[model samples]
Target: MAFHYPNGTPYNNHEAPKSKKQVKKQKSIQFGKRGMDFEEEINKSNAYYLSRNTAVIHKKPTPVQIVKVDYPSRSAAVIKEAYFRQASTTDYNGVYNGFYLDFEAKETKNKTSFPFKNFHQHQIDHIRQCLAQKGICFVLLWFSSLNRCFFFSGEALVTYWAEQETTGKKSLPLAIIEKNGIEIQIGIAPRIPYLDAVEQYIQSKKGVAMNDN
Candidate 1:
């Protein structure tokens, strides 16, 4: 018997119903044998930042309500049943250079555009709230198919999201993203060197403020 989701649909332990070895092989092929996921790369990057005392960012743990628990042994306890209690705000948050940082990391297989459905209203609202406090809010978007990554500003994303309601745009085109977002070069040590992009964004903001003044 296979495990079924709350919706009654059987969960495919693998993305496709493939054998364990086959799934492993496929993942190696997909990630060029490195087998690193976007979140994993970001985690590595965060760890690198922390090691040098540059920044302290961590992934926010999802809140879950444990409905049942099983104590198989004195030292081992397994969660028999659990459910998400509420929606999460974002993936990572921390402080760097006396600035509060908040961001969500997401990836898409789409080559031409990133679907707006990937983002939730609550996450958008949370970003807006952070921006109100002058926190550095942004999103790290990974285009897996294109092998590209970008640092997109929270304000621009919020603006585009608001326009979607009236414009009826279903996705953000790659061209628009290229125009507005900073491209992040994938690296080996830190994997996704996103802090460089953050620094650039901060400088750009300062330039705009100087011009305004």
Candidate 2:
């Protein structure tokens, strides 16, 4: 069976088609002041947390099925054929302050709204299961163009995603996220301090619970 991406798009197993025009345009792109990429920043932050014994979050390794391997040398083997097994759960999961933390990190160029397509049904289901076990589940969304980040609860994302099943809203509006999500400030050295956002989210939830009582 042909492999399919999460969106049902057939996997382009073949090497990406070469485009001479695209290559030329990419070569002409300008370079300027640069910073660590979003994912890298998050990785460094995770490292920092681990170093301090604050958290033990780590990115999950891609699950792959190896089909063929070549024994090139006594201590070397080359994986010739392999394929990813299936969609993955959220990235970066660990125990933090006695709480199970699980989250997916995503970055988008669009400054207005966050497209729901970034998330998959399997991931949503995983988050739901985690929540059922009393784990802290969320998504870390980065608006790169605007240099803004938000920690959105898995519960909120699930609610909106379910609404799409009936309301036909494909994307989450920026305004709603601004109100419901916890904004995270980007920093140097470690970069995205998402746990800070998580702390704020926890506080807000506690505040709501207190108000309800």
Candidate 3:
């Protein structure tokens, strides 16, 4: 089975090179293979929000082009190869309290920083488009090792993303995230109760608007 990009180029998702310290720590904890699905938790949270009629968010589906398939006994089919229809933008998106919400979810084991290599150029371009339209765009970053999450606003993310080349920073530090993003506590009903953070973002936007006037 093989996968290709939309341009018919071979595609492979590879892990970024790790330092000796990271390798040593990884061997000790094996956190990479912990088998915890961060997106699954977000899906559960979305379900909870839907149940309460609070928001209508769904994970964005990636279109795949099936190249080869085998029909066995006319009962089932096996896909042999596929290609992505196009580069994806964001993860979850929907409407909440009359505001259009678009966001990405990410989980990292690094306690000190979130690697920028995890992101693609297409995603940043998409986020910029959404923000230009005044959309409520942000990212839900889960620090798996610490069991902590943060609501990293798209504006803040883009600012740092654009400065990467000049600043020579390969990752976004947790200290900066702590200063610009909203920390969210794990909860029961809505496991990642992110709307509260959205509310805060909205209020802050309003305050800025008022100040501008």
Best by TM-score: 1
Give the per-residue lDDT digits (tens) of candidate 3, residues 1-213.
Answer: 222225553322122333435433332222333544566577878888888999999876555688999887687888889765654678679999999999988878898999887677778889999999999999988888888889999999899999995887899999999999999988887888999999999999999999999
Residue ranges of candidate 3 with Cα displaced over 4 Å: 1-36, 69-80
Clashing pairs in 2: none
Which residue pairs in candidate 3 have backbone atoms (N, alpha carbon, C) closer than 3 angstroms, thus clashing? Answer: none
Whole-model lDDT per candidate? 0.81, 0.75, 0.79
lDDT score, candidate 3, position 162: 94
Of candidates 2 and 1, the better by lDDT = 1
Residue 185 Cα positional deviation in candidate 2, in Å, after optimal superposition = 0.6
> Per-residue alpha-carbon lDDT of model 2 for 108-172, expressed as tens digits?
67779988877778889999999899889999887777778899999999899899879887789
Runs in model 1 deviating more than 4 A are 1-36, 70-75
Worst 10 residues of 1 by lDDT: 25-34
> How does each model score on TM-score?
0.81, 0.80, 0.79
- Candidate 1 contains a number of clashing pairs equal to 0
lDDT of 1 by residue, 24-96 (tens): 3322212322344676578778888988899988876655689999999989999999875555587689999
Return the lDDT, model 3, position 153: 97
